[model samples]
Target: FGTDTANQVEEALKSFKQANVQTLVLDLRDNGGGYLTAATDILDLFFSSDEVIYQMKEKNSAAKKYYASTDSKYEFVNGYILVNGNTASASELTAGALQSEKGYQLVGTTTYGKGSAQTQKTLSDGSVLKYTYAKWMIPNGTCINGKGLTPDIEVENVSLDGISTKDVKETLKVDCVNTRIKSMQKMLNILGYSADREDGYFSVATQDALKKFEADNDLTVDGEYSQNDKQMMIARMMIYINNHENDKQYEYLMKIIK
Candidate 1:
């Protein structure tokens, strides 16, 4: 969220209205969150001016509710928010408000619980110190601190093993046991090659899968993982994700929407 995020969303809604689009899917996955005003501004686009968007509680103070300040610009018969583990703070705030206020269902994994708000102060030496001063809650008054909001429709994307080519520092071959091998194994599985196992062990089946990947991509058909192989595998992984061939979350969303 930023100063321009609400403006950008408003512009996009205008396009959607012109195209006669009634259903909406707001994807907030991996959004670490930003300006609280931006979140409220975007929420105003969908909520009535009198509705409560969220609530905040300061130390030793009563909870204060924030109401929508603007009339809705668009109203859809159905809407869904996509969230994941990285959806935190203001993003979580937006998702939780939409879920609680509008009855909009959330689709995907649990959010990154971040209910606390912080303020910064500059010291005499000009250094800045940030500290939590308040906690924010959803419209229904649930403070999602360490316990994140669970989705109404839970779905997960295909695993990427959370490793990349940069993480592979050494060549990997048969009988070697490492996280890099597990990453390569997962990638191979997603790319339609069977690596047999994904336990960080470079078994014979894993070597065969690597060789097949190399042969298919016109690289040298060696049963070993090298720097070039790592690069090529990463490229193929990107292509797979870009093509949305393994987007299980999206697939489930479409199934329910249809």
Candidate 2:
């Protein structure tokens, strides 16, 4: 949290510099946050010395300003900070600092706004007392306490549209043979409805599975995977994969559909 963490970050930056990486993307979609100093220290890497990165103001204590140090080691041409609803506290600090100070672009959805600073105090008992000590602000004096910072490029949590199977006919019944039938089977299995296999043949097992899926999802249970059923499955699979966005299997399913 103190020295070792800073050392690791420095080492990673060294590697990036050695590789001559110009564009850096820091993906902090699910990063919750940690030591406040660590956030500011990393923020220091992008800007020159004496630049105001962030501000800390408490009720009782005087306002404190955090400035960038002489640690502009990597002169990256551009920086992108990826964030979402799970990005909070230190993650927000880092994003806000870079955006406000260096004009770095933020991608993805809005962040989880938690701009309060906390301090740890040791009591007589051996236990520590942690309390909110200050509130942080961006360099422009913008407070991101309850309202999260919006991304410059707002990409919805779902994948882009038109990522489904192509050239679907109006009807697909049992024993129907189509090349995309295998893709349908793959998506069905991914959504937990067993298509049994992906042999590009619409067998009876696939039909039964489709019927059960349609019934469960409140679609027309006609035992036929028609155009309406394909549309319904597309919507259903989008929602399912959105919910399971972090799972690699669902991610692969998304890629295959595209």
The prediction achieving the highest TM-score against the true structure is 1
150-248 in candidate 1: lDDT tens per residue? Answer: 999999876554666665677788899987888888888888999998888999999998899999999889788888888888898888887754777
Residue 221 of model 2, lDDT score: 91
The deviation in Å at residue 146 for candidate 2 is: 0.9
Model 1, residue pairs in steric clash: none
For candidate 1, give the lDDT of residue 169: 70
lDDT of 1: 0.88
TM-score of each: 0.93, 0.61
**How high is the CA lDDT of each candidate model?**
0.88, 0.77
Stretches of model 2 off by over 4 angstroms after superposition: 1-3, 60-62, 125-127, 158-258
Residue 139: error of model 2 in Å? 2.0
Residue 49 lDDT in model 1? 81
